[model samples]
Structures are given as C-alpha cells and as structure tokens.
Target: MRTLIVTEFISLDGVIDSPGGGSHPRAGWTFKDVPFVEEAYEIKGREQLEAGAMLIGRVSYDEFAPVWPSMDDFAEYNEMPKYVVSSTLSNPEWHNTHVLRSLDDVAKLKQGDGAPILVHGSATLAQGLAAAGLVDRYHLLVFPILLGDGKRLFGSGDPHTRLDLVECEAYSNGVIKQVFDVVR
Candidate 1:
C-alpha cells in the first residue's frame, strides 16, 4: 500500500487557507510576516523529489493548474501524475491530470503501487482524509504568525487522530517544519 501525505503551510493558529495570494483579508500571509528563508522551503523540494504523484482538492487544482504548469519551480509537480478529487470537474487541462470523485477513490488510489501520494493545499480534502483515517502522514510548515479567523487545517468535529513526530526543524525565519506520521 502507498502512503497518503497531506502537506500545508499553516499559521500558528492552524489556519491553512490562502497562504498564497487570495481574496482573503490576510491573504498571502506566508510571505508577508515571515522573511524568505531558502532553507525553510527545502522540504518542498524534497517532497517533489520524493513524491510519486500529487493529489489535491478541486479548489487547489483550480488554483494550481492555471499557473503551476508555467512555473519552473514546480516543474516536477507539473509533470507528475496529478489527481484532483472533484465531482464537478469534468475536464482537466493540466498534463497527466486525473479526477477522482470521492474519498473512497482516494483510498483505492492509496492501495496502488508507487511512492507516497503527496497532498498539497487541500484543507477540506485533508480534513476529510484525516477524519476517514485515510491520511498516513502530515508535513506541516508552521508559520509563527496568527490569523485568528480563517479556514484551518484541522476541523473541529474530526475524529481524534494520533500522530507520531517523524521529524521537526525550526528555521531562521521562524517557520517550523513538522513531519508527523499518522498513527494507525
């Protein structure tokens, strides 16, 4: 069986929405308060190198598909087999993109052979996967600032899930890389 890993750049208060630019009042929070630390983002590069495929929600797919294809920084992601969980998305224009309708489909994908499937910027999807006990790991870069109101990475009503810390590092920019293995 393959592992399913959910990765996010989350805030101190657990907010994961709009780390990049968006319509939110505090959108683009990742770059605003924190100074750029190349070392802080090394995990991202490693994730691309290690991931066999990429999985994301419809919202993230929509946000990424439009621009990631043209970004050299995301070249690996652009070329990888990408799965978007969405019932409404009939056509995906991105290269090697596939649509999976539900979390059951995600579970089936996890049973297939390959390197771990990496999930990025999919808060709702991640929550669902976590609640369903489908997520096997979490790679979180916790920023030091707090945005009290926003969509968070973990939901309130989700069933309790235990995690064992696999690795952790605090960057000079105050962004901490926390890698956790979801306890089965």
Candidate 2:
C-alpha cells in the first residue's frame, strides 16, 4: 500500500492557517515573513518532492494555483501529479490535477502501485483522513511563533490520536521538523 503523508508548516500553538499571508484571518506567520532559512531547513521539502503523487484540499489548491504554477521555487509541487479532495469544485483550473469527490475515493486511489501520496495544507481533509485511519505518516514543520487564535490542526472534539515519533530535528533558524507514524 502507498503511504499517505500529511506535511504541514504549523505555528508553535498548532495553527496552520495562512502561513503564506493570503486573505485568511491569521496571515504571515512564517519564516518567510522574517526571511530566514537555515541550510538544514531545506531537506524535508526536498524529501516530500520524492513522493509520486500529491493529495491536496481544495482551499490549498485555490491558494496555491496562482503562485505555485507561476513560480520556480516549488518546482516539485508544480510538476507532481496532484489529486484534489473537494466537494463543491467541479473542474480544476490547474494543470495535471484531478478532483476527488469523496473521502472514500482516496482509499481506491491508494491501492494503485505508486510512490507515497503526500498531503499538504488540508486541515479539514487531514482530520477526516486521521479519523478514517488513512494517513500513514505525518511530517510537521513547526515554526517558532505561535498564533493564539486560528485554524488548528486538531479542532474541537477530535479523538485522541496516538503517534509514534519516527524522527525529529531542529533547524538553526528554530524550525522543528518532526516525523510521526500514526499508531493503530
């Protein structure tokens, strides 16, 4: 079975909302805002690029479509085959993208012979996957700052999840990269 990985850049307080300063309520709470990147900070992103397919939530797709396709920094993100999990959106404007109508479809797609499926910026989707026991590994890049109020990775009334830490590292610029395997 292909591993499903959820990768996120979160604040110390577990806020994953608007790390890129979009129109969202909590905006610009990222290392990009302060403009700092240690050499060690670059590895996880490159590693995620190795995944064969990317599964993203609709909101993340909308936020990323304009900049990622046009930019050169995230070449892997632009080039990778992307499967978007969305209910309302009929058609995707981005190239090399497919829309998944339901969460059940994720399991069917995972049965294929392919590299790991990586998920990014899909808070709601991630929660659903966690509930469904679909996610295999979780890679969290914890930033230095903390936002008291914002979209959290674990919302209210979420079930307690048990995760076994695979590995963890601290970057010079205070970014922490933690890898965990969801325990059954």
lDDT tens readout by residue for model 1, 39-109: 99999999999999999999999899888999999999988899999999987999999999999999999
Report every candidate's CA lDDT: 0.92, 0.82
Query: Each prediction's TM-score against the native?
Result: 0.98, 0.91
Q: List candidate 1 stretches off by more than 4 Å.
A: none
Looking at model 2, the pairs that clash are none
RMSD of 1: 0.7
